[model samples]
Target: MKKRLPLIFTSVLSLSVLLAGCGTTAKTGSTATPTTQATAAATTAATPAPKKDAEPFTVSLRHIQIGDAQKFRKAILDDVVKKTEGEIPGLKFELDGVEDQVNRFTKLPAEMAANNPPKIFDLFGGTGDALKFAKAGRLLDLTPIITELGIKDKFVNLSQFSLDGKVYGLPIGGSSEGFYYNVPMFEKYGIKPPTTWDELTAAAETLKKNGITPIAMGSKGAWVPNMLVNTLMGRYAGPDIVNQIPAGTKKWSDPEVVAALTTFQDWEKKGYFTKGELGLEYPDMLNQFVTGKAGMMFDGSWRSSVFKDPAQAKDLTNKVSYIALPGVANGKGDQTAINGNYSNGYGFSSSLKDNELKAVKAFIKNLYNEDMQVRGLLEDNLLPSMKLSDAAVGKVTDPIVKQVLESYKKAGSVFSHFDSTVPSDVYKETESQLQKLIAGKATPQEMADAIQKVQDAAIAKK
Candidate 1:
């Protein structure tokens, strides 16, 4: 959802295998053995006796797993919190849940600027977020903690969170951006899942003509529209364009990139997205789609679990399906490349006291492991960010998740969202330009030129 940098793996092979078949959907009741247990005896020989009664301390943990849709992820976090607290002498986690867009675009950046972020918080990787903070010495280098946890090699890609060979954060899960459509709505209209650009537009027209919003969208956060825009850009400009732009080898104002923006703007002019989408929030988009107000929605694969949860999805339970955006005719890039990202996750503040460090260590130990990774897949529909055992991947009864894996398998390659590849200033510029474009205040050429100007300055600064 946010931007990131070149992750550890140059290719998507690691995640491709993970998506092919991995992890269980079964809920686990196991409590993690204290990760520090092995070193306890060695530590006891050199350390002073601990006090029987320790002063209570609270570690602030800012997270984005808020709202009904995130309940499952929150439950997993609650379990880890419980286990971590049990192992710490007098530690308590002050969990603060905020909306994803606000946490990523507003609150977290302000906190990072003030050098007073919560002890642990949600983070995005790339030049704009984790890497930027890491360069400024605001984010803790998690290299040693991951190593001590014996999970340094477990993650599929850490490059997004790595700076100069030091790891800064760990992705919670892998995700791909695509369309999540209403199955019954498609059937009611006799429209099949669109796999070609013409078919996709035809389906939209069919739904729109029938008085249904063709696409469920919330533009209050530019990141929402940016998702579709990024995929389209990948189609027109080629998957390598994003990487080339940051290196000063390619320009954002390229004809193909502008064409992508133009295509998104065309959808806006056609009134394909929900009315007053600019006034709605991310959750509202999901609400509209789930209630049959819209025929389709472009979103991340992480959302697959929502359709399975009755409380969250309501009547939409077992009624939703997913599809990758159809390939554009005469597209320049790999038409089958899908948007995949392992860029969003938790990061710790660089400044921490002894007890806070211990809390951080315990948090990492309890959270980033095979068990929790599988739990994320099973309970939340999140693809595993860490490696699972050969026996871990089992029968996945959730059709939505199975479809997500199938979409990945069908893709010719995985292309990252541009936000993760560009400079933070350039990324913020794209967000601003996109909102303006959506509001009819800017043209596709204007948007591309504006973004390129910022990119030029950002590159000069380097």
Candidate 2:
């Protein structure tokens, strides 16, 4: 049988402390003698004219939807609305926003700054987060309400959503990134997975010695290379280090960061990756690894589904082993941490009127109920944020997803994926420079300096 996560705090809605539906009493008059004109005036005052001031109530629930997971979630939301419409009468949900991140975030912030905004929306969990809105007093304080609903105990990564001891949002899924290696190549070469930077380099050397490509990576989009660079940064300066760089407390050129970048440059020179990697695209990188041309690939854990896709080669499914990139030797950072995040969950707006608040609150309560939580795990292969029931755990059948979960267990903490914590302009500049850094056209210092300049400018604008 497959395994499931155990749930806690499941029955709060059924509690007797819940608010009762309020009732109103109609007015009655005492018997009295009245003139015809007085009685007519009294009757006219008691009657109401057409309700001229009433308006349609609407709440926009915005989210960036992409890929299979978002598709599944949208379907779930549709079902939820179907089941909930009658329970929250007169409430209108407008699902709004572009599916891509660029449009999603840009539009969201502008709306937030203006008079109109999505009343509740799914949010990213890192630096470019709902917390910024929360800090600006634009988001609702969900702390007391979440506590009442016992939602705080439902998620494992609430720390990511929390600010100044209060949570601003809840996550739909937990995100993790790590290495997925070809087990066949490792065993054939008598090479074990590395646990430190030196050991990892040694393993790469061994693979090169045997005419095997060490790491399968594509840098065409730039984001690909940052994964390795970010992981190296975590190992060198610890998880919180890069976070400071964006806030102007630290520079990208700090020696430790330089060292991390230098190491990244060194890896390229060592020929651990494919030739002209900056020209390679993502699919080619996956193809290289899955087809056994390379010994390992670095990517998102969500790729597990693709690895197991029936359309892909049979070799990938049976031969891959997911593992964390080894830590830096004698580094100041937490050796066991991973580059990860939680994303896609509701964030309430401060602008909601009383009726809107009540309706949205009820929706949030239903959103994380056991049924939806289980469906996310079983149908989506998501690292669910909600606590699960034993029955739900038993429904998870993917071994690779299970492995990814166990690997995350080794992390003492999770750092943001580099892009999530940096300004889009800064992130773009840094990612673009990574291609140059990888191709030996740019030195680590140059890359770091360029990144710092962009970040500094973005911060100044803020």
Best by lDDT: 1
For model 2, residues 1-462, the per-residue Cα lDDT tens digits are 123222222243233123222422233553332333445776899999876743557777776655443565567777776555556767777877465445445777787678466777767655566666777787787888888888768776776567898888788776677788888788899888776667777888898999889899888867777878888888887788868888788788898889889888887888998877878977788888888878888887756666555456456665677778777766666888887767557778878788798777787777767788777665555677877767777787777778777777778977876666776678778877888888777999999999898888888987
What's the lDDT for residue 53 in model 1? 88
Per-prediction TM-score, please?
0.87, 0.72
Task: Encode model 1's per-residue lDDT on 85-197: one tens digit a residue.
Answer: 99998999999999887898889999989989999999998878899999999989898888888899989888789999999988999999899999988999999889889
RMSD of each: 19.4, 13.8
Q: Looking at model 2, report the run of 10 residues with the lowest lDDT sum.
A: 1-10
Give Cα-based local distance difference scores for all models.
0.89, 0.74
Q: What residue runs in model 1 are displaced by over 4 Å at the alpha carbon? A: 1-51
Report the C-alpha displacement of residue 165, candidate 2, in angstroms: 4.6
Question: Quick one: best TM-score, which candidate?
Answer: 1
